[model samples]
Target: MKLKTTLFLLFSILGFSQQNNPASTDSIKKTNIFKLGEVIVTNHQNQETTNRVTSKTMESQNKMEVSRALNLLPGINLTASGSRNESMVTIRGFDLRQVPVYMDGIPVYVPYDGYVDLARFTTFDLAAITVSKGFSSIIYGPNSLGGAINLVSRKPTKKFEFDGSLGLIDTDGQRSNLNIGTNLGKFYVQGGLSYLDRKYYQMSKDFVPMKNEDGKERDNLYRTDQKVSIKIGWTPNKNSEYALGYINQKGEKGNPVYAGSDTQNSLLARPRYWQWPNWDKESIYFISNTHLNDKNNFKTRLYYDKFKNLLISYDDANYTSITKPYAFQSFYDDYTYGANLEYESRFIPKNTLKFAVQFKEDVHRENNAGEPVRRFDDQTITIGLEDIYKVTAKFTVIPGVSYNSRENKQAQDYNSTTKAISDYPNAGKSEALNAQIGLFYQFTELQKLGASVSQKTRFATIKDRYSYRMGTAIPNPDLKPETALNYELNYNVQFFGKLNFQTAIFYSSLTNVILSISNVEPGKSQMQNFGEAEYKGIEAQLSYTPIQKLIITANYTYLERKNITNPAVHFTDVPNTKVIGTVEYAPLEALKLIANTEFNSSRYSTSYGISVPDYTLLNGFVSTKVLKYVSIDAGINNISDRNYSLVEGYPEEGRNFFVTVRFFNSN
Candidate 1:
């Protein structure tokens, strides 16, 4: 459907729904979300600059993956790495390496590249996902140059609870998940398991044939993922609590070949036959919160995370044969261990003070076919202090500062010509200081205005400073950290009991950006801190419950990014404009209908000027309660069957259908 037609239909439905009978309210209680992982800031008027996506929202939209779920929020855009077949999201034009990801307050990004494939993170076990924008809390530790995303797990508050779902996608795809938990006053336990698999996906009928692809089912479009999670908690008293958690995820996927017309002599556009035989991660963590006295509280978190993956490249589309020069196998084994300690005190009246210290160590080991393993190690430390002071009944001030340092303990250099390995020279060390302040004014009970400015820094990842890029790049261990100064103004207001609106204007100035400079040596590039950039954006969100039976929500974002040092170099993958709208209507208590639409403006696919065309998508779903304890949902995504690509050559799935049945019982 056309964008204009879709919007008209949405509003037409809203107009027709006004005459319908009121729908009954749902009785399901709010799921218990873990609070220990949250960054505590001033609670004045609850104006902290954080957005959240609850489990209910994920279920309503059928967003089974973290990346897709996050896209529902303003200022966040979903993107794909076609060559790697990995899903990612950018926040206000910043990539995942700068935004970072966390599970229960522990960093989960890959230690080497500082990125995690969000598609591999299933949403079945999460209670909520929280995103903090530019003005993030300093207590989150280092590397939050853009923002932070935290996945909050569920905690059992009832004696017995169970939730499970089984789903079928297209014809061959399948998905299933189960979550069970129990609480016994002082002790509680929760566990979850989820699996998703798909053999192939069909392309839109309008998709034109290319050298590497034709109409119908796309080649090598298969994926499988499985995850298991468990947590145990003990509450000794009202003032003390402890928890231990474990999570494991396993996945495998194939990369479809390039299907665009830019294939003449351009290596970047060449088709690739790539597959990931193994993509796995595991994490174990312990967290504790204790109240020292009426004036103070302390918290601690300790975690160990491991990641392993294997990539195989073939010369052609054939399933076998790796004898060609472009064919090879790569493997990575990485791990990280970290600890955080925080103390909060309210000894001074009308003031809250927080102190936090964090330590982390990362190790990366990798090798190619017939090559010896190369290893790298690094250590990081951060100390932060923040205070929330109430200046008056309607005014609040929050100020924070953090000191961060990183040291490269060991790095191995491999010489392809000699087949020899040696220690890398000039082991790098770096330090940075970050500070931020926010001012908030509560003009009235239903209106608030806030402003904030922050200075953040991100250290170069191990790969950034030392990767040879398969002989195409030189290792520059002396690369400095990248920094960004951010400014934002936000307003929140409620016009009526059913209407709410929020808006923000944000700007960021980036300096010493890490960019790959060509021809540092003959035919080789080097990563250096040599670029400057600016990102400015405006975001607005609105929600209205016209009546008890109908609700409508919409969000829009406009972003502009400029390369100050090189005007010719364009920012890739992030759309200049994005809009999303959703409508939920319940004509009956047991039955509901939902429709959603999304639009994205054209975006650069490569720094060399290639662009992906703009597109709009429409989706619809029907949900109904069957038995007293069961519910069923049927949905169709990309109702228009329009052919669209986030990246230049990678077309997304089209006109897909899904059916899900859920069972739940809580007491």
Candidate 2:
């Protein structure tokens, strides 16, 4: 017998006994304490949820990447058991690609595939990372079916401010970052630069690779990167502001050597001779806002991005075999243009309304042997509106709707050697209409309840409808947009002002699901609208402080996924249950310690008869202020060294250590 959930629904009923009077003093102190599954956006206070909207000591976390930091949230998983290129953040059994990333209100994703590499984004210049799960705000543009994630950058208000850090890892790696900003009365300037050099990380002692691929440690897994960015802003008055920004980034990484077993061996070829030669990006943008009064306000953003990636495939294992050792190069380029404009009004009492329009276009080019093989464009236009109505002092309602239009233009696929076009070309147009409604009620000073029902639609990506998927899948320009009808319910309870518990349950019905299955030929798949899916899950988080300087938190999620079109089969990448626990303790005024534990249930890949068993991991961190301007941070990841694989053949790195020395000004 197998257990589907850790704890049954009884925990929901038991929470009622813990509700108590609200604590005003402790509430202010809790403002900087980042709680699990808590919304941290700085938007207007709404009746849907209540908590601190800002953090004063966000820099204390010493986060290198956003993926690991976000893993602490309920229902958010950084599962390593999949392809490294896949989005690391999974929400309620939905792929992260379905969750869009917004930077200062601009959506950012790979125009060709709709994937965002969360690990490549550093947290050095972030003000906060805001996440909105099911029934998210309508202001976020299209392709946000599962939810939305926003990386809010910082704004400088001082004459001069600078923050920098340098870190060293036991795995022969180094990381350095610098951020500086200044305010010149009416004008402001800010800039940041970061660099990372890392080598192959060691695995746990318990992990042992196959005979031929075995080494003292993981092989051919190293990365080097550099990034630079600048932003200039003008603030004429308290109610108006304008800004311009530019960013350039470059990266080179080696794919891990693929170890194979007798049962399966797809990884045996590419991992041995191919590597990413270049991954580069350039972006320039402008943003402006005007706040005339509560009755009228406006904001707009315009941006252009250029992305280039290259993969080099070698003809020989030694890479330098004396006999005409040549290599082949494949290139992908995307030139993207996007703009967004929004208007808000409050002409009626007890009501707030918002309207927005957005435009986006991606011109893509694929080249092999220094010759163009494919050229296409993806474009979209959207209009949306939402209103918040206060029906009573303790009750509120929100309703929203959006219309989207998308088209693919000038798509052509031709052979590099013969210059002959493929018989089947991809070009099409599509449209979708989405709507949602939400309710929030404050039952008491210490408790609240919220629920929402929404229908969301996500458009197809360029690769989703065009790419061959390396011979495993064929192109299909007729693929339709995927849609999901989501239902959500949540409850919040507070105890003695120092403890809090939040629980949520959600169900989603997905239709016209686009999937790649064996339709083109035996053992091969084609992109098509082939299946229907349903997902339901329950999640809960607890935050409590037993003492003045210590805090402990825990969260868990139980999920069920049904392939409505085929109930006997299960999805390949999701786990059945997950639990996370953490402790933060400060024994001295200048010292702080943090520890965390993560557990995931086994996963089954039905098509391949592969099962990755359950596993648990532990990590620890310690930080101390050594001087007025300096702090030291040291930590060890995978302290328990339980050898495991999130994605089969791609084992998790073993115990590793890192130390950082940070510097900043008092102002």
Q: Would you estimate the TM-scores of all the predictions?
A: 0.94, 0.89
Deviation in Å, model 1, residue 498 alpha carbon: 0.8
Q: Over all chains combined, what TM-score does candidate 2 have?
A: 0.89
Model 1's number of clashes is 0
Clash totals for all models, in order?
A: 0, 3
Model 2 regions lying over 4 Å from their true place: 1-62, 80-87, 184-186, 260-262, 269-272, 320-327, 422-426, 444-446
Candidate 1 residue pairs in clash (backbone atoms < 3 Å) = none
Query: What TM-score does candidate 1 get on C-alpha atoms?
Result: 0.94
Best candidate, lDDT: 1
Q: Kindly list the per-residue Cα lDDT of model 2 for residues 54-131, writing each as its tens digit.
A: 222234445566666566677776754233433266788777668887666667678888887776676666655667
lDDT agreement with native, every candidate: 0.87, 0.72
